[model samples]
Target chain A: MRARVLVRPKAGILDPQGQAVERALPALGFDGVRNVHVGRLIELDVEDASQLPEMCEKLLANPLIEDYEIVQ
Target chain B: MRFPGSCDDVDALLAAEMVGEAEILWHGEHNLRGVDAIVVPGGFSYGDYLRPGAIARFSPVMESVMAFAREGGPVLGICNGFQILCEAGMLPGALLTNVSLQFVCRQVTVEATGASSAFTGGFAAGARLSIPVKHTTGRFYAPAAELDRLEQAGQVVLRYAPGENPNGSLRDIAGVCNETGTVMGLMPHPEHAVDPLTGSTDGLKLFQALRDHVGSLLAA
Candidate 1:
């Protein structure tokens, strides 16, 4: 099974990377960037898709800093 | 200034006194295979350039740290290591520059919330103790919603003592854990105060807890 994990910072955390991207957007001629919070995209090929949830809980994403969704 | 010249201090201290083995990975080399636990020791990695953990996050070593944590290995990040863990996306929330914009160095009291973590198992609920916090950018920031979720999930493992919120962290929080409690990051330097000669020995219990957990896991 293949799983794509979308890991994003928890709602209240400041995303410096996202902020930097937002700052550069207007200069890059794409001024529509708003509320852009950057996160990690991890794609994994797991033996079983049912393990995705456990993977998310154990390591794919940190619950304190990030929330993740597994798309299989 | 960075002290102790590497993670060896933590490793040697843990090994000699705590009955556990800690291997210090320099520059994040070598895959973290055959390791049950990991520690991102405190120091000015990459000279704290750009940001505390900013440069170190991209190191080859972090790749192994990430892989190990993904496989359910217990990981702990202290001081600068904590900043790196957040940057490496292993821990939640970002540690920003201190609100006061000063490098704080002193023994401060902390309250352990007993959030059921590998690092906090030795402490009782609502336990109060003193630990040293020495950093310039130790302020912890997270969205209110995320903080609420963390609290609701019992992930807030350590908190600053009442009226001792040195870094202006939300809810007086000093340290926290991932949902499963295998990963933890905090601003305090528990490794620094592990020895009684360092003014307070409260830090020993933290490392002892990790050692004990790893031992139990091995025995199991």
Candidate 2:
């Protein structure tokens, strides 16, 4: 089975990279974006799908700093 | 000790040797070789492929380092080592990208919060040291509750002086130690400040404190 883990800075955590992109978009004629947050996507193949969250808890995501949701 | 991509290992080793015998422990090894103290230096370990210090935190050697620190051994992590320690769950809080979103490199003043940690044992409370910091993801982040707890417990060992916060760490925190005060991590490169030729010897005080901590442990 393959799973995707989306890792993001926890809510209220500052996201400078996302803010930089959001600022640039307005300068290039895009607008109306608010509260932009950047994150990473990790796709992996594993033998047991049930262990995806455990994998994220152990390695794929840092619970202290990031939140992860697994998609199958 | 040196990880594969650790560029500051030599400087750390040299600084440690000035106080006592020093060595290079491989990141792939599980043995600490009976060292009294450990220094995880700075660099783009694993090429910083993911978040800084994310991958290197799981190195085989870190298991032993964790065990050593848990047993009250003195361990200091500088820059990337600091990031690795935080990612490894050995320290509270996380380092985020700088608020300015730029790689900052400069000499800054950091004050010792207290003589509570093994690394800060040589300095009196409020003793200020000049050290150079160079990094992008150096802003320390912790939830409000955790931040209050760390402050109350004296786990915050060093803080940037007023107006000297290069990376905008929370409350200007520059270094933090575990509850036992045996393990510590900081963003500034103390190894780079040990020599007068480098324009500051304030860093030597930290190394000396490590040596004294080890000596006291051996004597006990």
Candidate 3:
């Protein structure tokens, strides 16, 4: 099975990378883009999907500052 | 000893030992059985592949390190080690990129908020020390509720002095300890500032605190 994990900094947490991208967007002629946040996508090949949540909690995302979603 | 990424921490420890700062018996990750305290030195473990400490936390050695912390053994994580501890769920908050989107590498003053943990016990309340921080992602963040609990429980051990919070750490938190005070994670490199040759020895007090705590424990 193939699983994808999306890890994003929790809401209200400062996302410098996201902000930087937002700033650059205006110069590139992109307008009215608001609320940009940067996150990571991790893909993995595993045999069992049941253990993915455990993997997310243990390594893919930090519960304190990030929220993650698993897509199969 | 664990990885080549943070050899500077090991070099600093050796320098400290040579100066009689503390008696340290350095060992590799596999042999932490008789260790009194575990210092997870700063480094880009696993090349920081997924996240700074994300992959490294799953290393076989970390299993022993976590068990050691759970057994009330003192665990100190510096820089990348700090990142690992947070990822390991051993520390309270997570380190995010600096709000400025820059890698801050310089000396800043951090103050002791309280003398509750083995790491900060040697410093008086509000005592400030100069330490060097070098990282692109050092801003500390946690849920508001968790932050409040850390503050109330006196687990917030260190904070960047006013106007010295280089990164955008919430409440300027530079370091913190667990409720039991056996585990700690900090952004600055205390090991790098232990000698006057480095222009300051303010970082020595942190190591001194650990030595004192472990000494008292041995005596008990």
Q: In terms of TM-score, which candidate is strongest?
A: 2
Query: What are the models' TM-scores?
Result: 0.71, 0.97, 0.92
What digit string (tens of lDDT, one per residue) describes model 1 on residues B119-156? Answer: 88878888987888888888887778888999999889
- Model 1 achieves a DockQ score of 0.09
Question: Better model by TM-score, 1 or 2?
Answer: 2
Enumerate residue pairs that collide in model 2.
none
lDDT of 1 at A23: 86
After superposition, candidate 1 runs with Cα above 4 Å error? A1-72, B1-17
| Models ranked on lDDT | 2, 3, 1
Backbone collision count in every prediction? 7, 0, 0
Best by lDDT: 2
Candidate maximizing DockQ: 3
Ranking by DockQ: 3, 2, 1
Candidate 3 achieves a global lDDT of 0.82
For candidate 3, lDDT tens digit of each residue in B149-204? 99999889999999999989999999999989989999999888887888888887
Clashes of 3: 0
Candidate 3 structure quality by residue, lDDT tens digits, A1-72: 988999998887777788898999999999999989989899999999999999888777877778999999
Where does the lowest 10-residue lDDT sum fall in candidate 2 chain B? Answer: B114-123
Clashing pairs in 1: A12-B142, A12-B143, A13-B143, A64-B92, A65-B92, A65-B93, B28-B61
Q: Can you write out model 2's per-residue Cα lDDT over B110-213, one digit (the tens) per residue?
A: 99987488988867888999999999989998999999999999999999999999987989999999998999999999999999999998898999988988
Instruction: After the best TM-score superposition of candidate 2, give how far the Cα of residue B9 lies from its true spot, in angstroms.
Output: 0.3
True-vs-predicted CA distance for residue B197, candidate 3, Å: 1.2
